[model samples]
Target: MTPTTAFKVLTGEQMAALEKDGSFAGAPVDLADGYIHLSTFEQLTETVDKHFAGHDDLHVVEVDLEALGDAVKWEESRGGQLFPHLYGPLTLDVVVAYGPLHRDGTGQVQRPITG
Candidate 1:
């Protein structure tokens, strides 16, 4: 598996761990059901716009994995642990992150997928 894909899957698992441990700050967000919320970064951006800034006293930002360089930054920015969930039943080595979907029948993570 490519380094990129491996990381994506790792990110998903990390998210699950965080959920299970209930360490997320702010809201009690439960994301440990082993489901990947697939949406284009573009779609995520649109949703952010429609919500209106300061509408709910919460802010959202869509960041490219390419820009993430540290764990502290990721945890602080996303408000939760993020892990890659390999969409299909396949070898972990083959997973790659294709935006909100598997691009090359593989999945990758840009965040911690485990605690």
Candidate 2:
């Protein structure tokens, strides 16, 4: 499936730093992996369920892939799906919208509304 945009799941602290600094290098895991991990709208729920379950103060930032240029690559990841990976720092300018990550009664993360 072709995805026009992707979402970055970050901690509140990381979001704050990105907003404050105008750009973010990478999260620890991203640093270790050499690229920032991102999830498509379809992948968000699973990403949250697998990685950020029971976590609080998390933020889901909508990203414009075109704005990121060629630095964004779709690489094979979980379940053999190709996930978006950013080779460079993430600039706040590319963020379309962001909000707190919350769960619904079924325990799945509520997808953030984005423009």
Candidate 3:
């Protein structure tokens, strides 16, 4: 079953831009790919380790997939896993929670706290 919520990893600069603009077109890779890449909670840690590693100023944005409706597509990616791809600008209104990416003592990525 596909999860209804997923995470978008962004740099501090990207997060700031999203805040300032109210909507984010996407990061460079997202622009090239023509969609914003998102990962389910299960995929978050590896996504961070693989793509976002070595970056300290990273943030995890929890988004409501249902809120995006048809704009979100589930497509095959890394290891044939189904990942969510947003076909439109990611508006801040759809964000349920967001914060700096943190890890637990066991080295697992911790989900952001909801404010």
Candidate 4:
């Protein structure tokens, strides 16, 4: 089932760019793959550990999928799980909230609050 929202993980530069430019083309891997990768709330932890490990100044941004219309696609990846892929550049307007990566006491990364 598709969730109403998804999350994108960004490095400090990328986060700053998005904030300043009001949009982001994609990360290098996203550019190579032809889409922006997004992780569901449930998939956040492992996505960080596996792909973003050792990366500094990471941030997590909450995205409103409904606002993007058809741009968001759910495709099978990583053990056959459906991940959200944005076919177009990510605009800041669709990002309802964002903040530096933070983990709860349980060690799970927390999503930034909306509003």
Q: Which candidate is the best by TM-score?
A: 3
lDDT values, one for every candidate: 0.28, 0.87, 0.92, 0.93
lDDT of 2 by residue, 19-76 (tens): 8998989899999999999999888989988988778889988888989889999999
lDDT of candidate 2 at residue 110, scale 0 to 100: 67
Ranking 2 against 4 by TM-score, winner: 4
lDDT of 4 by residue, 29-102 (tens): 99999999999999999899899998879999999999999999999999999999999999999998999999
**What's the C-alpha lDDT at position 27 in model 4?**
96
lDDT of 4 at 94: 96
* Rank ordering of all candidates by TM-score, starting from the highest: 3, 4, 2, 1
Q: How would you encode candidate 3's per-residue C-alpha lDDT over 1-115 as one tens digit per residue? A: 7788899999999999988898999999999999999999989999999997788999999999999999999999999988999999999999999999999998889898862
Candidate 3 TM-score over all chains jointly = 0.96
Which candidate wins on lDDT?
A: 4
Residue lDDT tens for model 1, 6-71: 232113434344346533222222244332332233233333344323333222212233232232
Off by over 4 Å in 4: none
TM-score, one value per model: 0.22, 0.90, 0.96, 0.96
TM-score computed on alpha carbons, candidate 2: 0.90
